[model samples]
Target: MYTLLSGLWKYMFQKDEYCVLILGLDNAGKTTFLEQTKTKFSRNYKGMNLSKITTTVGLNIGTIDVGSARLMFWDLGGQEELQSLWDKYYAESHGVIYVIDSTDEERLSESKIAFEKMITSEVLEGVPLLVLANKQDIETCLSVGDIKTAFSDCAPKIGKRDCLVQPCSALTGNGFRLSTEWLEWLLTVLGSNGISCVM
Candidate 1:
């Protein structure tokens, strides 16, 4: 009877947890986006100073609870050497958020290359993907359509998984609502499909 009551209590109160990865090139604002997301979603979280945030050399982690779902974000370093480590976490992640520095036109191709490699990995197959075209607060950043066009060739590699390229400014918190909503929606879909995201 005690075991049954404990199980019932946990079932009623435990939140379903999911892991999401934030990947991008160096200086693409992956850490900034993670900070903003935590600040916006976690009521008591007062995130760090965005400007003072440095390039992540290893990994930065943050957690936020939305409704009954808890999302654990892994913000990995984007340096070439660090990218090799990304796949080590791919098998465990439920989704991926790839941030692109829209204002850095010179690195667009490079970013696309990394993105293509990430999506093609067999371990990440069927994982939901969110491509954030960040730095939209800059007057000259590329638009969502522009980024999409640049990555159009990779669509076949993306397959039928849930994917979205959203315009956002990590510094200004633009597009966070849509991003989080999509994650919440993923929880619903995964639940219906009997997929377990708990780790």
Candidate 2:
């Protein structure tokens, strides 16, 4: 009877949660992306001033529930020194949302190196990666195709993980539609894999 009751309770009210890691190089718009996500999804969320968003020193975390699923996002500092600590959270991450400054052509190579390193980490094996070519509203922003082409060689090195590249603008919210699509995709993956979003 105890087992039966427990099963019934879960069947009636079970929530799926997922841990998402947001990574990128310094000034890559990681924090802004996170804040935008929260503002867009959370209930009655009062948003911060985007222009006031500063570089993260350690981490910023937020949670949002979509249907029966809850997404826990970890926005980590992108400084060169802070990057060494990224591996610490890899084992627990269900997915990765890598933000890139699409308008910053000068740092493309540097960003690629950082991206390659993160996706190639043994701890990140098989984790789904959603690459956001952020700041797309900017005049000089790279197209999603161009960004993909730049990372073409290194992308294949990401193992068997599922990946997607989409354009976004964390500041203007011009590309938030992609964020919705991404969450739906993530939910489908989590369901098929029987992954629990408990962490």
Candidate 3:
């Protein structure tokens, strides 16, 4: 039984990664959100993606551990056309994150579209969703109520969707800790019940 014991030890030492998909309209600060997350728990993770423009064609993958589980954050393309291809990844996603460019009043409609597509997609149902209404530092951001109303208008909450709208400013690192804190809490709850999350 040496082989069996060795295999069990290997599995026990291995860390499981939960896939968290982050999506938003172009310039919604998704890449920045990830960079900040890395910087938070890690000793010194410099978030340079903040200054660069991102056009995510495939996917931007980032990993951070909550307790024992490594979270894989997927920073999806915010470009209008690329977003059309996002449905394929939903099947592989463990959770959904809708990042909003709160400064872009005109693009709020697009966020509605993305959130709608995710809620309606057959593979994404029942997954917990967190909507980061980002760019709160900007003067032109829509209020949290407005963003929530937008989602409520789409008719998902009434149907049993786990969602939260948090006003965040990734540029200044304003509300990131709150969001990640919730993430840790959620993972803890799920893990306690044996959700296969690696600690």
Best by TM-score: 1
Q: Model 3 segments beyond 4 Å from truth?
A: 155-158, 176-180, 189-199
Q: Which residue segments of model 2 deviate by more than 4 Å?
A: 1-7, 176-179
Task: Indicate whether candidate 1 or candidate 2 has the larger TM-score.
Answer: 1
TM accuracy, model 3? 0.85
TM-score per candidate, chains pooled: 0.93, 0.92, 0.85
For candidate 1, what's the RMSD? 1.7
Residue 178 error, candidate 3, Å: 4.7
Model 1: lDDT equals 0.87
lDDT of 2 by residue, 1-199 (tens): 9999998988778777889899998899988888888998988998899999989999999988899888899999988899999999998888899999999999999899899889889988888888899999998789999999999999678777777777888888787584578778777776666766553
**Clash number for each model:** 0, 1, 4
- Candidates 1 and 3 compared: the better one by TM-score is 1
CA lDDT, every prediction?
Answer: 0.87, 0.87, 0.74
TM-score comparison, 2 vs 3, better candidate: 2
lDDT computed for candidate 2: 0.87
lDDT of 3 at 126: 68
